[model samples]
Target: MKLETLDALLAARAAKRAVALVTALDGHSEWVVEPGAPPSGLPADLLEAVRQALASDRSGVVEHDGRDWFVQAHNPPLRMLIVGAVHITQALAPMAAMAGYEVTVIDPRRGFAAAERFPGVRVDGDWPDEALERLVPDARTAVVTLTHDPKLDDPALHVALRSEAFYIGCLGSRRTHAARLDRLRNAGFDDADCARLHGPAGLDLGARSPAEIAVSVLAETVRALRRPEG
Candidate 1:
């Protein structure tokens, strides 16, 4: 109708808030409503048609005459969990943050697990098992263990393998990983569960320094998260 009304409608759509536009099409005016919004200026039967259009996964463009109305869907945020507060993690946290992960560092040692070390990263100075018990891991969560300690890493790894976490990796040598696998097998973890562990964690990039190792770990983490079924 008016320029200001069109501007407001566009602004609301861009902001991803629910809004509707009524325009004349085929000699009749129709209301184009977002999902969960009531229809206006259109026949009752056409309400279901509008709902189907809004529910579609594809980006929407409702055309009436020479005018077009757009509706956008909002995406959820990403979350990542680091199972250690070691040197590699110091580097990993910042890298994960840059890559849009809501990074969290979990450890029992308060001295090594301070927010000061991680800056903007969320630091949880608690035993991994206990902390994870309180905060259940979800499908969106990515778990990485950098502490070479079995006592700390084992409990966390066990919990992570059982959960729906997209990634579960542990830092160690190949020999160490083999031993870890043996231990997990003894602890009732089947081949399927053992398969989930990315031991000697990080890509096969021959990373030596903690920073380089962090990069490799993050790379592997991304790959694993993107391909959960693999």
Candidate 2:
């Protein structure tokens, strides 16, 4: 345990990369190797401990006091795309951000879609389709529409249905959702594509205020993200 080895270990941890620590418990001076690096002819016990640590979900390996310990790093953050700058979105974006999501707010209206209103969020004032086209959505991304305006919400829904975005939702009443489905059908979206939308978007929590509605929507989004697809 020289200063250089300790520095390398700290550097690997800071970079969010996995590393293994080899120490002498009872053996004589030997070579030490980092995780994912070629291993030297270390003792059988140390080598076996390193192998087990790598095989497990843990990211780090420790050998001291005649024992080996492994520790796993935290998972990567999530990405959330909210397709509206309304009051509900204002509440939702911060909540999602606090919940460890990289929140991005998309609204075509420049007046409503500014950073001042939605502090740390990435605001995009372009049409949802065009904006999302440039920034492709993936399975790690959650997409939600809160405008309740067809002009903005419908196009985003269309794009999300075709993309691999994990969660797609739009806010509206049940009757309004039925009308939206009719329009989507008229626009050539079949039942399968339309089924991707979680309209009246949110859990059936009987939400009344924008903040409460945002919570329900966030809860449903979390469920959709974690649920295994059939």
Candidate whose TM-score is highest:
1
- Would you list the C-alpha lDDT of every candidate in the order shown? 0.76, 0.77
**Per-prediction TM-score, please?**
0.70, 0.69
Candidate 1 residue runs with Cα over 4 Å from true position = 1-75, 227-230
| Clash pairs detected, candidate 1 | none
How would you encode candidate 1's per-residue C-alpha lDDT over 1-230 as one tens digit per residue? 56775676677645545545545434344344554656455444344445554444234556543655443332234567888899999999999989878888999986889778888889998899877776677765788888888899999988888898878888999999999999999999999999888988989998999999999989988887665456
> Which residue pairs come into collision in candidate 2?
none
In candidate 2, where is summed lDDT lowest over 10 consecutive residues?
68-77
